[model samples]
Target chain A: MEQKTAIEAFAALAQETRLGVFRLLVQAGPDGLTAGDIAAHIGVPASTLSHHLGILERAGLLRSWRVQRQIYYATDYEGTRRLLAFLMEDCCRGLPELCGTALSDLVACCPKPTVDA
Target chain B: MEQKTAIEAFAALAQETRLGVFRLLVQAGPDGLTAGDIAAHIGVPASTLSHHLGILERAGLLRSWRVQRQIYYATDYEGTRRLLAFLMEDCCRGLPELCGTALSDLVACCPKPTVDA
Candidate 1:
């Protein structure tokens, strides 16, 4: 992803409500949660949730799809991965040597790359 | 780190100049770079560079220290790790079988954990 894209994604996540919403959608998986369900889960007014969701969508951190009458919002894994890749691009290239400490911490937090990866 | 800290860090990184400054510091490694050098490398005015540096420092993404007449700025690895950990906390816990795709992408971008890890 370009740095501008990365910046927008970061800005979208910088707010508490949006971050909570993103994590909730991430936990809810790729199928995501319907707007009503998300609002109920987050205990926010419909208007507030709508605003945050719009910001996330504009930033490309979340994607929404319509199934019947319901609109479900989920974390855009591709966009999310792109942002993650952008941030770690420089350090990971150096591998286990130069960025050792940070790299180790990152590895511990990140999962193993499966064959599909 | 608390969500507030993470928010601050993300906010600091949301801007182009600050993110450039941060990546420069990260690439510069733990030894960091002097304020003057950072300004020179980033090609920003002294005042603009200083302002951006202060924001990064306050947000806990960067740390500065005085060595003789120079003030060196470096990525605060622990603080950075905290933000990264916060972002990945929920998904990583679900492991390979769950948050799979995003996790795999993360792993591909991250390094392997050392024995000490």
Candidate 2:
């Protein structure tokens, strides 16, 4: 998590279209989405979406693979974790208690739905 | 958690100096640091650092308050959480088991230093 790398990751998500794409991919999960599907869901032209995807992949926030002729993209969880670790490195400086709970909640992720009786 | 807001936060941290400043404040913890200290530590001039600080504060990544004559900046944990929540929102879309553990590691900050004989 070098400073330069972190900045690149931040820059990758700084745009509205790119941010939306990343979120969509995150929600899409391990299965990921093909570039065409992503472009369609995001209501952007394929050409435009391709550029954004390239930026994200270069920033290490995304990973892509080809299935036959279609290229799929998924959120790079390891890259994401690295970015988060860099942001929170040395947090509270040996006193995790000061920021642990609040920060930990960030990772709580999708809460389970409750059923009605 | 709005798309625009998330973009703003990402943009705020995309720059080198700003990222350094934010990391410094995160390390500084709740006590924060004065603008002067931040500039000195980051090796940037007061005027330049002031501009970056203003951007980060507006994006909600950092919070600033005045004490007597000096202004202090600290990482806004609430804001950080919000940004992270947005990033991981619907993460795995109800399948927390898919991403929970990995994401949870993000909050495992500030590991205690080991003691040796």
DockQ values of all predictions: 0.43, 0.49
What is the C-alpha lDDT profile of model 1 across B1-117, one tens digit per residue?
Answer: 677777888899999999889878766777889999999988999999999999999998889999999999987877777676666555523535554556464632222221211
Expressed as tens digits, the lDDT of each residue in A12-34 for candidate 1 is 99998888888787667677889
Q: Kindly state the fnat score of candidate 2.
A: 0.75
User: TM-score for every candidate vs. truth?
Assistant: 0.85, 0.88
Candidate with the greatest TM-score versus the true structure: 2
Candidate 2's residue-wise lDDT over A21-94, tens digit each? 99898878778999999999999998999999999999998999999999999988878877877777776664
C-alpha root-mean-square deviation, candidate 1: 4.6
Worst 10 residues of 2 chain A by lDDT: A108-117
User: Interface RMSD, candidate 1?
Assistant: 2.8
